[model samples]
Target: MSTYAIGDIQGCYEPFRRLLDKIHFDPVKDTLWIAGDLVNRGPGSLEVMRFLFSIRDSVIAVLGNHDLHLLGVAYANRKPGKQDTLTDILLADDREELLTWLRHLKIMHSDAKLGYAMTHAGIPPQWSLTEAAGYARELEAALRSDQFPVFLKDMYGNQPDCWHESLSGTDRLRIITNYFTRMRFCRADGTLDLITKDSANEAPEGFIPWFAHPHRKTVNDQILFGHWAALEGKTDTPQVYALDTGCVWGGQLTAMRLEDKQIFSCGCDDV
Candidate 1:
């Protein structure tokens, strides 16, 4: 009856399965919290989505940037790039089923009893758990609505780089999405610096990893997140877990058992 939080799959189905096996996952008793990026840039996006969907009841996942990009390309007609590997999902017979399931997925998941929270990327330092949950709900509601295409259409961009209570319309939604799915580093003032892709050691001037901000509101909450594979599951800050090990980029797939905080990995063969 253990729970495991896994990093980004990014279509690396073989490694995903191997990691699950390494953990000796029992679907009937074990629950999985996925840190998102379940598809794209690997050879098995379609298979990965289908597998996750099949065991949907045993899993909880947040949306990652690549996941949203797949949605944008599917529903909003956003153009797929050369490296995009989501065509199989879009063209699958169960495409609607899979995408709809994905659209309804949470941007954040929390369990006070378990003392952990999950997001594709770190929650911004500005908001407390309650505020972050409310904002996540707001965006999730929009995504599940008929107006979702509007969100997908307006979802791109890094503008309005700071949070504000008064933000409305696409601007508000986009910023929230950015924080949940695309953020890595930010300034002390809560201004997001989305351009820096290096590890925390090389963080640019005036900016630091979101979890490292001294005033971060959710410091008491254990956060599980992906999207920054360069961290390689390393964040010196206590209780902040970086699970993405860049499996799609020739790194390993990683998972952590929640009860004992034990880590497991499987080498990826997708290179």
Candidate 2:
């Protein structure tokens, strides 16, 4: 069975399906590792969720910033942003079922046997894979807990942009979530520049892309992530894959077959 890792769908269901077709995906024999941002921005958020839920057993999807925003708006009474196209999802009859599935999604996924790890954004430079995994579990626990709405209420913000082992309460959970969902450029010390959304070279002074950090702890391991669509599926670093090709922005949908590292793409003009 092949395992294919895909980039952010961002509610672009047609491109997602076409990319799957190009890869010849078999739900029963193949596994799909989605890098996140499963909903938002494009049309088809509800359809995407429903399809993924139907093939739940073969898919491993992590929660992205958009996914969390959907949850926050749904459960915490958070206001939807002006650019959001999540109204269909919010107004759907199966809204509860769809949101519940998204709520329970992981913050990170790893397979030592497959030699690959995935998160919505990317792992911070300061943390080892084990540490990142532990932090992922921590955030996942908060997301899946009864107090999830409470967590969502406090989930937004860019403060506490650096990691501290001593961090606790909402501060700890927010930073962990940011690292796994919204991260882009950061200092070697793992302090995130949460405001910048530009390409890799446009990073603010004193900062570098997370995977480009000179002393990155997990540099030797294969890591797959999305969220930085400006990257357009390119990172000069070996074994570190950026799969988000900006399908929602009229670019291509990308996927990497883990077994052989073969790349596949489908244009999103019709999306």
Candidate 3:
């Protein structure tokens, strides 16, 4: 059985399906690791959710920032943004089922046997793999609890841009969430620059792509992530893989086979 890690689908269901077909995916034998942003921005959010839900046993997914925003809108009564295309999901008959499944997805996933660790975005420089896993569990527990809506209400923000062991409550959760989902550029010391969405080379003066941080503890671990579509599936760092190819933005949908690292793609011009 093979394992494939796919980039953000972002509601581009047609392209996503085509890419899966291109890889000749076999649900019974193949395991699919999704890098997240499973819904939003593009068309077919409902279709994507339904398909993944049907194939839940063969799939492993993490949550992206857009996924969290959807949760906020659904549970926290936060309004959807003007550009969001999540209305279909919100209106679906199986909305609660889909959202509940999404809410339970882990923030980070790893397999020691596969020699890979994945999150929607890259892990912070300051976090050892063990620490990152622990923090992910903390946030995951809150999301799965009855107080999740309350946590969702406090989930949005850019404050406390750095990590500290002493940080508590919403502030700590928000920073941890940002590191796993919204992160792109951050300082060498692990302080996030959440505002910058430019390409890696255009990082603000004091920041660099999270994977590029010099002292990163996960440098020796194979890391798979998808948030920065600007990288178009390249990190130049041998141990870190960037999987998002901007399919929602009309670029190609991409997937990489874990065993051989062979890449597959499907154009999204009509997505």
RMSD of candidate 3 to true structure, Å? 1.0
lDDT of 2: 0.94
What does each candidate score in C-alpha RMSD? 1.2, 1.0, 1.0
The number of the candidate with the highest lDDT is 2
TM-score of each: 0.98, 0.98, 0.98
- Model 3, span 79-158: residue lDDT tens: 99999999999998999999999999989999999999999998999998999999999999999999999999999999
| Per-residue lDDT over 45-93 for candidate 1, one digit per residue giving the tens place of the 0 to 100 score | 9999999999999999999999999999998989999999998998899
Name the weakest run of 10 consecutive residues (lDDT summed) in model 1: 262-271
Off by over 4 Å in 3: none
lDDT of 2 by residue, 61-133 (tens): 9999999999999999999999999999999999999899899999999999999999999999999999999
TM-score of 1: 0.98
